[model samples]
Target: MHNAKPLPTYLVQRFQGWKATSYAENSAWYRRLASEGQHPRAMIISCCDSRVHVTSIFGADTGEFFIHRNIANLVPPYKPDGQQHGTSAAVEYAVTALKVAHVIVMGHSSCGGVKGCLDMCSGNAPQLEEKSSFVGRWMDILRPGYDRVVERKPDDMARALEKESVLVSLENLMTFPFVRAAVESQDLSIHGLWHDIGSGSLECYDPKANGYVVV
Candidate 1:
């Protein structure tokens, strides 16, 4: 492996600024959190897209949410093969150890991962079809979601697939016994959200309405 490089100057400066301002102002709260450990009320599964800022959207404090991000924010179905599963591990820890009260799967518009999935499913991304492609394999979890949205008109395909990613993740979360247990015991609630980047709008999936409603 190559030697690791130090952080860029801009990022270092930004960190120093935050340390002087936000950290200084909340030192006591930070110390208390360190001593007691984080007890976030929610676990958020969101896209790795830089545009979707979960904390900013909720105006949440540092220790208020446990966030896990992955390509397209997809969660694979419960699998216990003793292999490494990063997303699954995060979900397990959040549900069984932290006992987060809510788990939110949030998707967004113009997601590259979703586009890749769309291309792969449509046989347009031959590279992703290779067995050794990590992104491709990870996106296999979203194939069922693609299938659900594939019949839509071409103009609406991408957005429908993006929303389907959120719904699929929510469904897979329930396949985990701990998540289901928490929900059954009235300790956990699951949510699906989609954000429109261009419009700066947020929508929540309402099962009763059978569609997303602006929030």
Candidate 2:
């Protein structure tokens, strides 16, 4: 195997400081967690964007959330076709193995992945349409969501589609038999959320309201 370069000095120093401070203060708790393994209560599927801090937003402690991040925070419909599927694998593990009580799909405003899907669907981003484009193929999950929001004004379409991504993921999550069974059995619940980065606002999907409401 090829030898990899060392970590950046700044990151190393920051980790050292955290270990000396935060980790030191909670060493017993950390040790207990290490010995018992994790038992997170929720599974949060969120965008890969650096600005959306899942744990910080919920004030979650370590081992409190089983988190997964991907472009656009989209979950494709369940397909057991003997192919490689990372998101589906994560979902299966979270529901079946981890037995998380809640599965939350969170989207964000001004998401580049959402914008790319909008552009690609609008015929403005031909590069993303290429067969070799992983992002484009992965974003195919959001096309139905775009169709649902296409009637909105041009300026509002992007944000609408962003919220739609959360709805789409929540819907797709149910397509998995294990997830559906868990939800039906009342062992698990699903939620959709959208975060406005600039405004520091959060909105949750309300089935009764048929749209997102401020949280």
Candidate 3:
């Protein structure tokens, strides 16, 4: 088997190098950014897949976006169970604290997590184990979409599953009290984007059209 160990090491080296280069080339900007605090224009909820980086894909520089990533980009309904609530906490910070004007829930093509839902692959399903793997369990938040998509469209299974997952996450975003308040008060707007990694393009969801249009 091709070991994956070398990849993280390579990435660490590259990240260190990038930080050094940034310091050398843009020390003033970096310093200013560090001092000024992040005033990101948008709060992005995206998949944790290393292949799909919100900043890199959006061509955003440091502090341009407040980002929260999780497996399959899933967002659970607002829950107060005395949990760490990382995603919820980030959303709270972005909306209430940072006051980001826009919030985007972005999904991507060929997502292994999405594919797992479509295929009903238990191997990829999340569970709370002795070792503490929680990604799969978190992905369960999007399971309703998987079931709904399968029931609604038995054909063209893949696309339906992916699209429905985005819709589901969008719906869940409203479950947060702060998000709903901002949305209702017009302080924030929410957008959904389906990214085509293959074509290096994005299709934005249009609530008016009830579909995605290339953007």
Candidate 4:
């Protein structure tokens, strides 16, 4: 605790600015949200990359989306092993507790996590191959996806694997019993999306086409 310091001057200044402007103008709205609890319509599982702004891309407001950010926006298959599964825990809370109508797995271009996986797979990143690497263990969840896309043309390999991360997550989410039940009953729907940050383009998975179509 001794190592914990006060907020940086820049962050403090930014917070003060927010309090004076955004918070001042929407004090009542903020209070209402605090009292009522959140009732978001969708759950978005996306990469934690600073460049990927899920809320801004969708123009979402406070409490509008139950968001979970991870290395590559992966959802591991249902295991119920009584282990510490942060991503699965968030999924359970969003699906069973919050009853979000839709669950979205969004991947993005030039994802560092995806690139790390590619490097690890190609034997270029030995550090991630070590036993104690937290990121290595987590990125293992995307190994299947990387393997599936490794045989593709070299030029398309990165982009293909990026999209595969989204697809892999959507598939793993279905492994959850509750999620399957909800989807079967039409209570919940799942979506897979790949976003191009530079161009702000989004491509969605189309089962019929067996590929991502720009949206």
The deviation in Å at residue 201 for candidate 4 is 0.6
Model 1 regions more than 4 Å off: 152-154
Q: Could you tell me the TM-score of candidate 4?
A: 0.97
Who is ahead in TM-score, 2 or 3? 2
Which digits, one per residue and each the tens of the lDDT, describe model 4 over residues 18-88? 99999999999999999999999999999999999999999999989999999988999999998899999
Off by over 4 Å in 2: 152-155
Give per-residue CA lDDT, model 2, range 78-162, as digits (tens). Answer: 9999999999999999999999999999999999999999999999999999999999999889999988888665468999999
Model 2: per-residue Cα lDDT at residue 138: 90
State the lDDT of candidate 3 residue by residue for 93-188, as single tens digits.
Answer: 999999999999998888877776655433433343223546446656777887777567567776666777788988998999999999999999
Give each model's whole-structure lDDT.
Answer: 0.94, 0.95, 0.81, 0.94
Give TM per candidate. Answer: 0.97, 0.97, 0.85, 0.97
Candidate 1: the clashing residue pairs are: none
RMSD values for the candidates in order, in angstroms, are: 1.2, 1.1, 4.5, 1.0
Report the Cα lDDT for residue 21, model 3: 89
Q: What is the descending lDDT order?
A: 2, 1, 4, 3
